[model samples]
Structure formats: C-alpha cells, structure tokens
Target: MFVKNGNCNFFSQKLTFNTLVVPSQPIIAPVGSDVTLPCQLDPVKDLRDMMVGWVRHDLTPGYIHIRNNHLDFLIDQNSLYLGRTSVSESRLQQGDMSLSLTRVRVSDGGKYSYFKCP
Candidate 1:
C-alpha cells in the first residue's frame, strides 16, 4: 500500500513510516550578533503535541535539546549550552523548526542537528 501527505507525495512501499523532515541551511553571523537555524517537517501526521530535538556536534558526545509544546529542555550534562540556548516556532502547522541563538560568539560557529516527531 501507499500513503499520501500534505504535499501530495506518494510513498510506495515502506513497512513503517517515519516523520517527514527537512534540514535547515547553515547560517552565518558576526560575533555578538543573533542567528537563527531553520529546519522543517512535512505532513507531520498529528503534531498537535510532539517532541523536537536539536543537537550540536562537539568533541564530546554532543548536546541533545528537547522542546515540547512551549518548554525547552537542554540536556543537563552539556554545560556549553547552559543558559544561552533557546528554540521557538511561530507556527508548527507551517513546519518551522527555527532555533534562535542570541549573542552569537565565535565559539558558536558550528553545524547543528535537529529532529522532530509527532
């Protein structure tokens, strides 16, 4: 069997279906400036209440961010993001996983990973 989503795309033969996701392009900003990373998901099934995770690659195991509803959950083990990280979505319906980073620093220049689920 096949399934169709909001974009009217057809999936021909998969035993299980995972969420449709899109990667946000990397952003460049000057020191002390603000930066926003944009990611997206399509046909989110039922995202009325889902979980979103954002992470950054590092020397260590990396950082794991959990955002649910209107709350932000940054893994306590990672001290780099202690209190300088935040995520927001103006409209989940429109597939917005834009993460806002304030006071951008030279150390903050790196590729970040993001994931969303319903």
Candidate 2:
C-alpha cells in the first residue's frame, strides 16, 4: 500500500492484510507536547476484533501500546508509556491506526512501528 495526498493505493493477494502508513518526513514535536504517529490499513476493514500494537525499537521492552478485542491491554506495555498512549476510538473503524502519545519527553524521539494482526 502507498499513500499520497491522503489517498491510499492498495495491492494484495489476501483479502485481509495490514498496511501501515508513516509520514514521508520525520515528525518533530516539542518536549512536553503531544504527537500522533500516523498509521493505517489499506483496503480499510473493521479492526474491532483485531490486535493492534505500537512499538519503538529504541525503547526497553519496545511496546508502547496494544489494542485487542476492542479494548486497550497494557500488561506488557513499557512502564514509561503506561499512562501516556492511546488510539482514537472514533477513527479506528475508518482504518486509522494512529497512536497518540501525550506529554512527550526528549527520550520519546525514535522510530515507531505499527502492527495489525488477525
């Protein structure tokens, strides 16, 4: 899948697959501000029953957030992000898999990956 100008082009052999969308350029946010890491699934489908995970390779334990069974589960989430990450419920159904990181800190700067699983 490729996204340009808020439009997405999807190509796949399977009926269901995960397609993550990241910005073409790096995202910069001031310390203490909030930032949204953009991601989505192409050929959009309802994700209420799937598992969505966000991770940063630079962080310990990696996991930033995980959603499953229509609920946010944090048992394996990193302590640093225990209460600071979330996905927009209002937009999830529309294929929006973006992560909302609040009260950003300097250490929060890094590459993130979004995962979707059946």
Candidate 3:
C-alpha cells in the first residue's frame, strides 16, 4: 500500500505466504536527464491485476504513477511529474515496477517509494 501523510510517503505490503518486494538503492541523476527507480518482487508473481503506485517522498498527494486493471490512472498525479513518468505494461507480470522519469529536474531529487498491492 502507498500512504501519504504530511510530506512523507509510506510504502508497505502484506504477503499471503512468503514474498518480498525489493527496491533499488539510491539513484542519482543529472538535471534534464532520465532515471529509473527500480523495484521488483522476489519469487515473482503476475501483477497485472494488482495496484502499483509510485510517490516522491517530499510531495503531498504525490502519486507519480498508478497502474491498475491494465490502465494508468494519472488524474491524481503531481503536476511536476505530469507526462514524465511511466511503467512497462508488458513487464508488470514479470514483477518489474521500475519507474522511468524523463527530463529529471533538481526538484525531483529525493527518495521515491514504489508499492505493489493485490
């Protein structure tokens, strides 16, 4: 699950059996560049029907990208990130939730959290 409380964004998940979601280490990118925030599920499972969300830690109502039911919902996404984020639809079933951020800006420098929920 993804929660936004004040200026922080929290990511959490409950496994039915034994599963893990691993996010990549801190990523650094230059301004005007692009970066991918890596995240994956250990012992992969199909995520086509799941809800995937990404948020910038310092932003409120910080939904960068939200995917569910094979569609991306961006109505609540942050204005700073509009038209600049995406996830690979074909790779969802492969457990990849990495977010591709284009034309990165200094304002985008911060921790990001990714979550996958059934």
- Candidate 2 yields a Cα-based lDDT of 0.84
Which residue pairs in model 1 clash with each other? none
Best of the two (1, 3) by lDDT = 3
RMSD values, in order shown:
8.1, 10.1, 10.0
lDDT tens digits by residue: candidate 2, 3-114: 4554666554546455666789989999999999888778677777788889988878899999997899889899989799998776788888899999999888888888
What lDDT, from 0 to 1, does candidate 1 have?
0.63
Give lDDT tens digits, candidate 1, residues 1-118.
6677887978686454645454445567898887667655555443326777677767255664567776666654256556666655455546566567778778777777777665
Off by over 4 Å in 2: 1-14
Least accurate 10 contiguous residues by lDDT in model 2 = 1-10
Error of 2 at 90 (Å): 2.3
Across 2-115, the per-residue lDDT of candidate 3 in tens digits comes to 999999999999856635555446678899998888777766777888898898768987888999979999999999999999998877888777789999998898777777
- Whole-model Cα lDDT of every candidate shown, in order: 0.63, 0.84, 0.84
Give the Cα error of residue 109 in candidate 3, in Å. Answer: 0.7
Off by over 4 Å in 1: 1-25, 43-48, 59-61, 75-77
